[model samples]
Target: MKLQKLTGVWIPLVSIFFGLLAGAIIMLLFGYNPVAGYIALWNGAFEEPYYTGETIRLITPYILSGLAVAFAFRTGLLNIGVEGQVLVGWLASVWIGLAFNLPMIIHLPLAIIAAIIAGGLWGFIPGYLKAKFHVHEVIITIMMNYVALYSVNAIIRNVLTDGSERTEHVAETASLKVEWLTQLMPNSNVHAGIILAVGAALFYWYFIEKTKYGFELKAVGYNSYASEYAGMSVKRNIMVSMAISGGFAGLAGAMEGIGNFGYMTLNNGFTNIGFDGIAIALLGGNTAVGVVMAAGLFGVLKNGALNMPLSAGVPHELVDIITALIIFFVAASYMIILFREKLTNIFNNVKTKLQKGRGK
Candidate 1:
């Protein structure tokens, strides 16, 4: 068991090392100083209080989205619709913010709940279809993403605003911003959403590791037919798991609406927040602790990438390439394990032959 856990940790760490090495080679090829570029990347994410705050702010939504994807993965479902769920959640949370005029205690939670519900409902549609008719969730959820993209844009233009590209800022009562926190790192977007992210992470750990429902979900994931044969309600678990996953994603939108941006805007394309969650979840090994760590790494890479060009004369796209390479390594981790085992056997065989010859 100890070795198994170590293997999991080593796999991702090795993947990261190889990815950085590849990035360095690429930078060398392009006549850029790799060390300088990495230093700039590190500085961009942590050297200044403002950058640190922004990186934390960026990581907030990533944790939730990572949890969203990881939760679905645990339950043997593919929730590609998290992007759509985010749009609806953002729309709902922002709408509540725009429409409400209540006390902070009531207004804030209300908007959050609205977002959770909206995103949950969006996810429920595909979950229900899969549960009832055995549909492919990937296809349905992919289509839902486009529908969410267009519909949210339309709603923002037609209903939320009078044909405007963005809605007015949300009320301060509903906002996640706190003056003292902002004062801690002046001009930073960081807010109380980090608190929520931490709490959600704890909740995720407890639920997935401690609860009976989580066990059922895991069992279903291993073999849905077997779970059904053993008298588990496979259909019910599927729906509930997907809904829960969607709720996490919807909360991610709440971070955007009330925490970072404090408003909604029309997008010409997908923000890729949900898509990125897939990679985060993958890198995280679908664990709560893993998700948080993965999200932090992503935050650093993304926030730092923007500074590469200005600080080290390296294009930000290099970071993108590095990220892709890292993901590739992760996906190919099975082959890595196999290769390592093969090398180990070869070494053992050589050592045995050497010992026999010495004895003779």
Candidate 2:
């Protein structure tokens, strides 16, 4: 019985442990020292100050994007357009940052808000279509992503000074910089954005777990017909959920603009963070806390991969293989459950005999 209980608690951890062991085996096959590779990974991610800053930098955008995807998942929506929403948010922030001549305090926040609004509005289009015209969110969001991509590129090319493909650097006062911290960690871009991401996560947790509207959204996600029968307005909940999801994604773009890059340049390809957010959401299990934890784990993995190559001659791509294995094991937890059940039955029989002996 004790063994069975122990297995139940440790199954997931053991799965991850085995996954890492398998990853180490692959490293050995490649003539790399697995220990050295992992050590480097650890040192790169946390042992040094700069690397620790880098981990936080990587985590900043990931947290918001994870929240975006996780929020949609809670309501049973697969918002594939986080990429597009984030792009539009980026464009909006850059545009506002460059076009406005307001004071630093006002201008910076206004730009950030503009990004959020743009992201929300962009998301609203799909939500509205889904609610009214019965259009599928997946298809619409996918198409909209392309629209945001090209449209942003065009705008950047046409409106900026000398037709440059980038916006003017945000005003010094409007920037999200801490000169003291920057001096402490020279060349690092970590800033107040981490606070924003944390705040957003906390707000999301409260909204979903404590609010009536959150209940409506979850009810609608579970069953639209049942939600409507329960007197909840399903369509409204759907629209609200998408809008909120988009806003969170927009905040992600704003963080990139204000905290990381400082100005927007249209990238011709997909922003990989959007896709990464999907993995983060899945790993986090569609909960607010889960998303943050998952993002941290990914942050470690990303930083660690950079270190592995330097220390052990292991390719950074090996980290991807490890991540894949973790996901696979998590998905196949049913086997763990089966093994636990059999062990539990055996333990119960043993316990029953022990009880009989005590009674006699």
Candidate 3:
């Protein structure tokens, strides 16, 4: 029993260690100094104030997006629509930020609220369809992603800015400038979005841990038929879950738009933030603390990947290999769990046989 419990906790640690070992092996195979490459990557991620801020910046979006995916996972809904929700959220935030002439406090919150609403509505479409017509959410979400992409581009080009493929730069009043972010790294676009992400994480934890609604969602997730028989509205829960999940995804997009870029431009196409969130959620096991930590890990990797090629002569592609290996290890953790169990059983058997022989 103790061995089983220990295995539960140590499995994740072992997976991470093995993943790093695999990454090092790959680096050595490629004729690179693995230690130096890893050092360079770590230093690039943390050496300077600017790089630290960049890590936070990357983490901010990951936190929100990861929460989005995790939330749906908890509710038994696979929210593949987060990509579309993010795009719509970006469009809504920039459109409102550029068009409105409100004060900073009002404008910023309004833009965020609008983005959340837009994302929620986008999510609600799939939820309602699933509940009412039994349409597969995966197919709907995939189609909606492309729809949102094209729709946003069209709005930016035709209606919003006269075929410019971008919105006017948001007014200065609407930027998410915070003193700490600015003081920590001058000229960096990092801002209060980090606070927003943290707040969202806390809120999600509280919502799931301390609310009747949360219980309903979980019950529905485990078994909709049972939940319905037990007096919970499964349909309502589904709609609510999707809305809340998409709202988080929307906030991720809004952070990138208002806090980082201060405008919506079609230069980068869709960022795949929603899809990345799926990976984050999977790696984190759909838990609150796990999601936050996974997001931070991803942030560090991304920040360091940028500097690896230039500094260590280790191609940036190595980072991709590292990340892929990490994900593979995570996905295959059952093997580690099995190995641990077998070892524990063998040890116990040996201990028992020795004790019996001594008594005889």
Model 1 residue 51 CA deviation in Å:
0.6
Candidate-wise lDDT, in order: 0.92, 0.83, 0.85
Better model by TM-score, 1 or 2?
Answer: 1
Q: Over all chains combined, what TM-score does candidate 1 have? A: 0.93
Best candidate according to lDDT: 1
| Candidate 3 C-alpha lDDT tens digits along 207-253 | 98689998899889989999999999888898899889989989888
Lowest lDDT 10-residue stretch of candidate 3 = 4-13
lDDT of 2 by residue, 1-360 (tens): 797646544544565687799999998998989999888888888886678778888898899899998888899788999999998888788777777788887988898788889889888889889998889999999999999999888888887656787777876655677776677666778777788888889988998889998888888988999989989987888888999899988888888776788888868798877778887887676677777877888889998799887777889999999988876776677476788789999999999999999999
TM-score of each: 0.93, 0.88, 0.90
Winning model by TM-score = 1
Ranking by TM-score: 1, 3, 2
Candidate 1 residue 145 Cα shift, in angstroms, is 0.4
lDDT of 1 at 221: 88
